[model samples]
Target: MANDTGREAVKTVPETAGEDQQVQERIRKQIASELNLPQAKVKTTVTLLDEGNTIPFIARYRKEMTGELDENELRSIEERLQYLRSLEDRKKEVLRLIDEQGKLTADLKASIEKAGKLQEVEDLYRPYRQKRKTRASVAKERGLEPLAGWILSQPRRGSVLEEAAKYVNAAKEVPTAEDAVQGAMDILAESIADDPKVRAWVRRHTQDHGIVVTAAKNKEQESVYEMYYEYSEPVKRLPPHRTLAINRGEREDVLKVNLDVPADKIHEFIARQYIRGDSAAKETLQAVIADAYKRLIAPAVEREVRGLLTEQAEEHAIRIFAENLRNLLLQPPVKGKVALGVDPAYRTGCKLAVVDETGKLLEIAVTYPTPPNNKVAEAKAKFRQLIDKYRVELIVIGNGTASRETEQFVADLLKELGRPELQYIIVSEAGASVYSASKLAQGEFPDLDVAERSAISIARRMQDPLAELVKIDPKSIGVGQYQHDVTQKRLEESLGAVVESAVNHVGVDLNTASPSLLGYVAGVNGTIAKNIVAYREENGKFTDRKQLLKVPRLGAKAYEQCVGFLRISGGKNPLDGTPIHPESYGVVDSLFQELRLEREQLGTAQLKARLQEQQPEELAPQLGVGVPTLRDILDSLQRPGRDPREELPPPIFRTDVLKLEDLAPGMELHGTVRNVIDFGAFVDIGIKNDGLVHISQLSDRYVKHPMDVVSVGDTVTVWVLGVDEKKGRVSLTMKKP
Candidate 1:
């Protein structure tokens, strides 16, 4: 091998930590087993992460350190590491608290220590925890704990009344034998409820045998939850989307959701655990078991199971949202000569803005092309003036209110001009309003109103979706189903990672990136990003990556983490424009020398030919670099400052508009995927509303999810399935006509 290639990722880890070495080792081994990664790699990745290495940086620049773990794998490791560490911390806290109360036992400590989930640890700690004025605590105060224990022992030879009589004391508020026995039974029942083993068994039984039942709160009050007016489904088979739907309905008070589990099975299991053969206390224990199930155990387990279900649903929803957002943000940027953006509205006239080649706002104008005003001629005249003046090659219309009307008007106007080279594409304006209303937008275009600013955003989205979309909150992007319904914190976290990954994947142009885009780059916070922009503004464009070290609050660590992702075109060192890290410049220099090539030959046909002749595997050893790094270096050198997103299919530009009425069964039409959900993908086929291609109609073969067949921003050839003009819905099919 010519370099330390991809195949030679280091498989050994050196110990270095101030935390518990044993616990750290345990976490490393556990994560390794769980993710099926080599333990050495997991340990090394964890150490790098602990040293504050960002996932993107570690993934891209430290392939040898991580044994070639990608961003996804590294993220998984970080998540699991945090969870396991939290679990460890809680285990110590629980043990300390139990020992302070003088109730800790060897077996109990072992159980809690061995618990895998936070829930399990909490369960094991439940019995020793202090209670708030419960019947059991009251019984213990009345000196009936001994009686409860006696009953639990199931002494067949002893008389129940005699034992109860001994516990009776008027001074302690137990005046009768029956009252004494009842208080004792309360103690016994509470003990049964608090037992972790008993709780685990009951939880498992409920999950296996339970049914989720939902019923209407008021049948006469119509809602989208009408289908759930009287519905029941087995708990084990409930899908994530339905779980979220049911939870939302319940929260809105439109439906009452409950779990129905087999009580007889639970009671029998408890009876077998607590009762001895032919015990005199059998009947009394049976009553206690039933009471425990109904009043204490059942409700708690139901809530726990519901919470688990919601958590799973939330994770699933966040995963889907992340994928959809990733695709939407990674859409291939369309480089038009000069582009026009139109924010369409009915009562308000359509707001339009035109941008120059580099996304500079050239002009802003408005025309009432749709409804109420119906000023088509005026709109056309204004657009013609802007188009001819700017030499606009592409028109981007926002798919919002009155969008179809605007599109139709533009189609007719383009035909009247007979400019065959000009075309139009509809861009999703989901978060344009949010962005325009934000302080960031105000800062960017303080002179314009919200509508005009939104129009400009629409145009820039087609030019560079990632840069523009980063300004808005990911929740407002409207790419996922039930985004608003899922856990906001988790969704935001996942979407943030997606944006970060996309931004880092494409690499940011150091001189031109806005603070919003730069902020998403690994190791760059909002302040640091703002400082970078301000530095560029004050010092002029960055001439090399080394200038980043001079930015305020940007230390050596941050520079190391983020500099590789920051590309400087026409920099002093040509390698600065590539994704190749500064640390590996020596290796790259060695490679260039060995190939008899010069930096001037980068991205030339000569360089490509030379790089094609040598194998990274054969050259990695001699170059003293990892094969993965070498391959990436070769690719980056071949196309320095390249945007990976540009390699993907460009937006399908439309020269004509199609109405819902124009679509018929089996009419083959090309479209772009607007959004993806559990049920299907919504495709924009140049219409008022996006058409749905349900999962069943997505392919000739089985598709577990619509994403498996198509993604947001995917250009697909679809056929019309049917139309419901009354509902203004167009059903589409991805299957061949």
Candidate 2:
């Protein structure tokens, strides 16, 4: 609480535009309700970073204080707090500026204080703000202010210019009736632009209704902006990927992007704020206001609104990327076996690689199969020999060019051979090519061609998705929604965290983990991961988790954070294979003594059943540990050497892949949901293009979001209501048939 960073230390200070203590109380209560924290414990003085409250630490412990908040909720709270604090700072700065201009009235002060949002505060301060030289300045220079005010007075039904000529016959400017009116209109336009309330109203309306325009520059200007030449779409409808692409295009001078709102719609509000008389001069005032809107306010508002829209778009894109990365990392691994991968191509034939159980490539080959120039019979003979010679149990086929044709060939061969013991998996080859050509991939497969390496990668993907995926750049994974549009740093950080958390949760097998897989473990990196693997190979199997200390550059702090998450299966102590941290090994030992059983007597399945009967709260006091820790210990004890990823539903598999033409309306079938978008989710029913399950049709009841019920890779039951193969689109519903 002391001056830790040379900043003022305060307690429960509510600094915001809203002076009403009631508003602050309501928001505080909302936070309390969401976090499940008591009102008293939810004091404003409590910083998220207060000594005992790191995000992960508070989320894991202090469940009562935070109402059982998970890591996601905790992160949301942190973000919201930062945003609210920024809004408060901006409000204070705006108030100070208005007061400095000496135009701060009691009414204005009250308006600013009662403002519920940042936009409202900005509106009230607009009239007093400093700006660049504009049309109003030019009109004032021409000595037209007197004539403009006279028009607003609306003197009964005479030519306003005739009246203005008498007072505005200045030698400085406005020599003719037309010139006088033009000068007056300029002043009125500037005044309408200055009106604070009008600006606020227009801003809100624009946000709700604005649509950005993306277009290539004119043909004559094609040399300047070529990339955006064919672009056209509503801003609201533009996906994350397109938004990023267009933004990058504009940034690099390849496109012209403009954000627009209905000028007529915005002008109506300005007219209401400024035009208020019923005479010829009143008509003149309206005309001037219209001009002002065209010449000044519209352009400025467009720029401001466009900036805000871009920011919102970027944030949404970043969040989507983060979510996809999390799910991908948490996907289940097949685990523990070597695989043979095939990267198929036409001219170069299909590249093949045989990898050992540890995923080290032992051999590589090329075969002509299902190609522009087919050698189907010869290719089949060669493949059959390789399968037998290498003792391969699983065959991985990359879902790439000529894949379906290759699949047909493989299926025919399998039926003829009739070996039910052998299985084959179709792997998504989304980022295989990208990884094979990357510097890291080159270093790993130095002696092999990129295509051959890609084949090996496809095989390994089936064996362990998370482990193999970590080696490739996540951006190229193809599961992301508008991935290219998100902020690069935020996308990387979030994905990296997801990978780390998933790796630690599953607890890697120290003896066999590759550097890529081990790098994602908590408190471990490429160098340390490689060192551990090398040391294990030199010294033989790890007898105890404590032996990790022998690895070079791995310190005590690293071991403490990581050892609990790394399980050594088939090790000396049964507890070592469980998630129970070594620090709590003493408590575990005591629990065994109290239960009148030896360590050797405990079996995973039996212990799980016993713990359900004897709950943790009843055991916490006896064990002399916190109830939270006791609960974690009990959960871990039951699932010794558990792979967390294996808990999720398995990926949907296809047999004799069907086309859209094969389906009928109201036909109920199991399908895998491939991707989720704002409009709805796309389900792959083994058709050419995935079918859309519109948000409205996602549930029988009102469904607000597709994600509420479905996620990418979910095996769901969907009814195909319509299919338009010609249009390459399909419609599906989640309703029961």
Top candidate on TM-score is 1
Tens-digit lDDT track for model 1 on 1-737?
00111101221122245668888888889999999999999988988877777888899999988889988999999889988988888999999999999988998898988898998998898898888999989999999999998889998887777889998899999999999989989999999999998999999998998999999999999899999999999999998999999999999989999999989989999998998887778788999999999999999999999999999988988998899999999998887568999999999899999998778999999999888999988989999999999999999999888888889999999889999999998989999999999999999999999999999999999999999999999889998877888878788778888888999999999998899998888778887888899999999999989899899988888888888999988989999999999999999889989988899888799898889788999999998888999988988888887888988998888878788788889999988998898999899888888899999999999999888888898999999989999999999998897
| Regions more than 4 Å wrong, model 2 | 1-58, 61-65, 88-130, 137-196, 207-288, 302-325, 485-501, 504-564, 570-576, 598-606, 652-670, 684-703, 717-737
Against the reference, the lDDT scores of all candidates come to 0.89, 0.70
User: What's model 2's TM-score?
Assistant: 0.76
Model 2, 435: alpha-carbon shift in Å?
1.8
Which residue runs does candidate 1 get wrong by more than 4 Å?
Answer: 1-17
Residue range with the least summed lDDT across 10 consecutive positions in model 1: 1-10
lDDT of 1: 0.89
